[model samples]
Target chain A: MSNGYVFLSIAAMAVTTYLIRMLPMAIFRKKIENRWIKSFLYYVPYVVLSAMTFPAIFTSTGSVLGAASGCAVAIMLAYFDKGLLTVAIGAAAMAFIVQFAGM
Target chain B: MNLKEVKEGIKVGIPIALGYFAVSVAFGVSSVQSGVPFWGATLISLTNLTSAGQKAGVDVMAAGGSIFLIVLTTLIINMRYFLMGVSMSQKVEEKMPMWKRLLIAFGITDEIYAMSMSRSTHLTGSYMAGLIIPPIFGWTGGTLVGSVATGFMPSILAEAMGIALYGMFIAVIVPPSRRNGNVLLGVISAVILSVAFTYAPVLQIFSEWSVIIITVLVSAFMATFFPVKEGADNE
Candidate 1:
């Protein structure tokens, strides 16, 4: 793809992403009290995070073993109530070691 | 936005920014390696804070994908932002001006939305603004460094940083899930559905947007089958 195509793709993505994000804030004005909608909203964070993390995590670092090595450390540290930086960077470090070890 | 709220917002966002810097470094390397210029990568990160869409856009460009496909794929992959925005629309104080709300929407990533929403009190535009700044700079700055330093870093180090963002996502959810059974159930359900969606050949067609669909379905499932007491959110 040419440089123009790359810029064009970025523009397209930015506009679409911005509009999607803006629409919700632009439209919904009050607290949603409906049990179903409320519940759905409540769980959105966990659902989105888990959906994006799992399986995807196993492949994110270019190797399933490396990713899993990192993720296992992440879960343990996070379960022990580690800080975000510690758990996240620690996982990366562990993955780096695993990958460096030729895994 | 008061100075204090902005300070607190930056504080809450500091960890996110730290994580973003590490991850966007990977994004920088990937986009540049995929043939996107340094400035192009920087521009994408600045305008689109999305991790996947920005990275994937470069992938599409490298593969010679059509503009229509690029736009459509990003739209589908990023549809979750709409869900997040809708949810946040309710949480941010109704008194916040429309422009503030719109600007707040720009900073609504998975981590930001989760942190913003999970707070006990209503969000002000100032607070959200404070929250948004660090991650934006962290993301863009990392991309700039990564793209410029392409091939300068060892693959092992870069690979390690590659997974840090996912670890951040896990860190964000782990505490809440441990404290709240409803959250745990919702997470488990979403993970199960994600696995099913990934492996179930019939579900493969929705591959790109499966996360959005599964999230919506699992969230609704939690709401309907396992509603939690309202006070649970006060934490």
Candidate 2:
């Protein structure tokens, strides 16, 4: 891609993301009173994160076995309440091991 | 603007920054692999503090998609930030000025938002600035290193590291799901829906919009059936 294309795309993305994050914080001072709206907001992050992780994760490592091993280890570590670094490193390590073993 | 609060925020931000560094290194490498130049990838990280949104945007750009598509996909992928910003609007110190909020809002990532909201006291401009500063360096620095080093690193190690971001995502949601059934349901529903979108032939057409559609449907479903209890908004 040309420099201009990449630059323009980045600019557009940056502006779009900024507006989404900035609008509410800059404008809304009062508490959101609607139960459904509040609840939707509360759950949005988790659902988005979850949806993005799966299916995509399985293909991340180029090897299903390796990715699955890594994912399983990640889930196990995270379920035990491991910190983000620990869980992430653990998953990468597991994927490396599985890939190295060619299993 | 309190020094003490800024110091406290920096202290809390250390681990979060470290995590961002690891994940963003992977981001840098992958974006480069996807056809973005090293500097372009780093620039994206610098300009956009988000993880998933940046990834989605880069994917679109790498495919030669239009600027409009890039903005639209990023908007949908990042829609959750709107909600986070709303919650933050309520949580910020009562007297925080508009300019400070605007500047601080630029740095609101998922981790930053969660950390700020978890604080026992109302968020202060000084503390938020402190908390956000390190992660910016970590994210951008990691991208610089990763993108520049991609040519030298072995492919195996680079590919293995691909799982790091997902692992971090799992860390973010799994613990909460364990503590809250509503969260558990939301996650399960999202995973199932996402898989269906990926594998089901008929649903494959919507794969491009899967993240937005699935997020809205599942979040709304949970909100309607298992609305979070009042005053328990932190989760």
Candidate 3:
């Protein structure tokens, strides 16, 4: 909770993220020919996004029902290929409406 | 350093900047709600343009997680950028200098990478600067606005806005999941694992590491069992 710790955490995150983005461009000139590594990297973003969204999402709003309603709206909109802004706003609006109704 | 190419890149980047503004607004609001200071949240956006990585980083930081955990979580969440960097190294013009490469590396988010790779022509420093600068402003500006706006907003509205980031995440993964069975399975597997970590008593202790663990396990399993076809669309 200290400012020092917060600064360190941010610094660590920035350095780690930058290194991941920088190292390959700085050093590697050849393509990664390894199929398995390539596939794993390809799938990582999806897996990470899924893990972060679910369960955590159910608690994002005031109540589980509100969160669920919002989540459903989001999934429905996204399933139809809605843009990120649309899906986000739709989910927030749904949650607001549900919670406002005291459901 | 063609000004014309830079202008073209900026033109192409306009939509991406708009999209990043919306998402980073969500990020700023969510991180502040989770206890990150307004300035800290903005700094995170400035330094790390990535959505998922910054989200996970803020979670760890707000939890009072150790520096090691923060670095590890960010590293794992952003490992995909390594591939992007490699792909970009090959995509940019061959004579691009080291300093330019290093500087441009800082801006290689998923969207930027995808845009650069999709181009029929080789990437240039000026074009990349044009493409990267707007999104940086959009992302950092949105965070600043959201972080400041959180103080004036009602608590209920703030809470509702928390779902915005997750909704964006869903928008990102769901389309791809619908297209690729492997991606769908990877998503489901991660969700199951994440849920188990939250609910199961023994697994509760490791919940802090759940994102990395679930990501690695599910991704590795899918890669081993159902590797994407060699020539398949990576984007």
Candidate 4:
């Protein structure tokens, strides 16, 4: 793409991003008093993070074994109360090992 | 908005800025390495204030994804912020003008919102503005400097520093997970769902969007049904 096209693309993306971000607050100014709705919103981040992180663990090489091993490492680390860095590293390490071992 | 509140916002934001400095510098360096123009990456980092989304954007760009795919994927990743902004809107004084609300809302990162909401002090408009100062400067400053100095940092060093972002996430996930059983459930559920989606064959029809949808639905199902009682912050 040309420089102009790239700039336009970025601008378009930026606008979409900004409006998506700002619109909820603009539309829903009232405090969410509904219990179920509030509960749903509270879990939104956890859901978002999970969605983003899940596919990477098992699908790095289009294989299930590697992904499963990687996720097992991550879950173990998380269960043991290892910090984010540890979980990431543990999972990445397991994935790398699985890849190297050709298992 | 009084001068004092701005000052207080700056004071409160300083630590956040310091934290941003290290991580954002890593982000800047990586973006440049991934073939984005330094200015473009710097501007995105300055304006967006979202590290994971930016990283995902860079990865997509590196893989030569189309503009539509890139933006769509990023939008999907960042949808949680909409709810975050809603919660913040509820926290602020009702009559705050739209323009001011828009301006202040730019600073609603995970840390800043938490700190601002947790305070017992009734925040004036200036105080709220002040809260944004350090992080904005810290993030912008880090991106600007790191973009220019990108070539000097070794890749291994940059990779090591990238751990900071993960560390920040750990800090967030751990404390709360320990305090509440529901939070722990949410985290574990996320991990399990993530693994399942990655591995299962018949379910492979799910794209990134499906992963997001399923995770959100599953987590909301868990959290809503098993509601964790949270302590309210008195401001």
Candidate 5:
């Protein structure tokens, strides 16, 4: 909750992010070989987000049931290729309904 | 100065800026709800244009994560940018100076990189500037508005907005899983691992670093088994 800590944390995040972006430009002059490495890097985004979403999402709602209900809706909406806002609002509103219904 | 290219770049950047504007609002609301002060959230948005990384960073902070953990998590989540920067480096005009390369790399992002790569010719510094400037503004502006929005919005809606953060994360990971088996497998594996980490009493202690460790293990595991064919970068 301390502003100072949050600021420092954000600064660290910014520097780390900038370095990740800047390092290849600064040092990597050749095409990366090792298809395994390339493939691993390519899949990083999906895996990281996946791991972050699960378990975390289940606990993020007012109740576990609400989170689960909302999650089902999100899955269906996203499977249908709903936009970000649509999926977000859909899940949140559903969670709200579940919570309001005293589930 | 290639004013025409800059204008065109900005024009092309419009969609990206609008996207950033929308996404950053979610970030702002979440960060503030995560215990970040409004100004602190805005600053985070201003300095770190990373969507996933910034969100993850705030999540770590809200969890009372260590500085080292925050830095490492941010670095790992953002490692994709290294590949992006390398590809962008190859796309810039050959004579573009190293300093300019560094400057332009500051704006390297999924949207900016995509917009730049769509160009038939090499990108220039001015165009890169135009490409990033509005998105940056839109992102920061959205955060500014969102961080302060709790003052006006009802708590019920604010709580709903809280769930919206997870909604965004699901939105990002679920769609791709529908089409790509590798993505699907990676996601499914990570989900099972993460759920185990959360629910299993003995495994719960590893929760702090579980995501990062499992991400590496699952990704490398997928890459080894399901390597993408050469010349097709997911597309």
Candidate 6:
């Protein structure tokens, strides 16, 4: 990994990344006339997060038990409106302990 | 943009910052492990403000992947942010400066975007400041810690710490997943697709692409056909 090459790669990625985020807003400045499209956009986040998070939980150890322990604790905390940091650290701590005890 | 408002935004941003710190530390450690220098890790955390994009970029670089592959992977993984940015842009005052728009846009993660956009019409630059600073400190701090502690932590511990990212992610998902039947359907559908891509032959061609395209398309379609009755926007 040449320093120049890595720098250029990350820079390009950053530029493109920012552009991707900014472009849609610039284009759709006005309220979208399409209700269907609006509805779709509304629901996109829920699906996107699920798609991202589910595979992560299930695939971590090839067993849902470890993943479930973490997920259960996280869901409980989230239900109580705990902050993301608390939910994450608490569940991660539980998972760490469970995995440690197993070993 | 006043001092008081900025302080408020930062206050709201504290927990988000804390979450970002853990994730960014993982990112920094992984980047270093992949032969990326500490500066690169720090810079990436500072600039990218995206968990999936930075992580995927590092993985691609470590594997000596093509620029096209790296770009494609990140764009696909982060496409959802496009939607987020659009919605958030609406919440911002129309008279807001272009520079402010550009600067604040960099900080728009899922949580920040949700919290900020969900606000009423009373947003100010100070409010944005409050929203941005905590995560900035958390992320930068995490990278710094990871860069210094490189390799001191065991792989299992690191992997276990990674559960934090998943936990944060679950915190994000469970709310909407529980509320809307269609969102739940889209999630189940995407999971089945993801598993199929991993396990089923021939289907794997679309594995990486599946999450972005499936979620975007399915949720969009469902929203079009069956809108959430009590949408956050309507509230």
User: Which parts of model 5 are misplaced by more than 4 Å?
Assistant: A63-66, A96-103
Lowest summed-lDDT stretch of 10 residues in model 3 chain A? Answer: A1-10
Worst 10 residues of 2 chain A by lDDT: A24-33
lDDT per residue (tens digit) for residues A43-103 in model 5: 9988888888887877776688888888889888889999777888799889889888888
- i-RMS for every candidate (Å) is 4.0, 2.0, 0.9, 5.5, 1.8, 3.5
Best candidate (score: TM-score): 3
- Per residue, candidate 3 scores C-alpha lDDT tens digits across A58-92 of 99988789999999999999999998889999999
The models' CA-based lDDT, in order, is 0.79, 0.87, 0.90, 0.64, 0.83, 0.71
Clashing pairs in 5: none
Error of 1 at A14 (Å): 2.7
Q: Ten consecutive residues with minimal summed lDDT in candidate 6 chain A?
A: A58-67
Error of 6 at B136 (Å): 1.7
Query: How large is the C-alpha RMSD of every model relative to the true structure?
Result: 4.5, 2.3, 1.0, 5.5, 2.0, 3.6
State every prediction's TM-score relative to the real structure: 0.74, 0.90, 0.98, 0.73, 0.93, 0.80
Question: Rank by TM-score, descending?
Answer: 3, 5, 2, 6, 1, 4
Query: What DockQ results do all the predictions give, each relative to the true complex?
Result: 0.58, 0.71, 0.85, 0.25, 0.67, 0.48
Question: Which model is ahead, 2 or 4, in terms of DockQ?
Answer: 2
Which structure among the candidates has the greatest lDDT? Answer: 3
Order of the predicted models by DockQ, top scorer first? 3, 2, 5, 1, 6, 4
DockQ of structure 3:
0.85
Which ranking of candidates, highest lDDT first?
Answer: 3, 2, 5, 1, 6, 4
lDDT by residue for model 6 (B24-99), tens: 7766765786688988888888877887667667756876766776677667666667777777777887778777
Q: Is candidate 3 or candidate 4 better by lDDT?
A: 3
lDDT of 2 by residue, B23-57 (tens): 89988887887789999999999999888788878
Docking class of 1: medium
lDDT of 6 at A37: 60
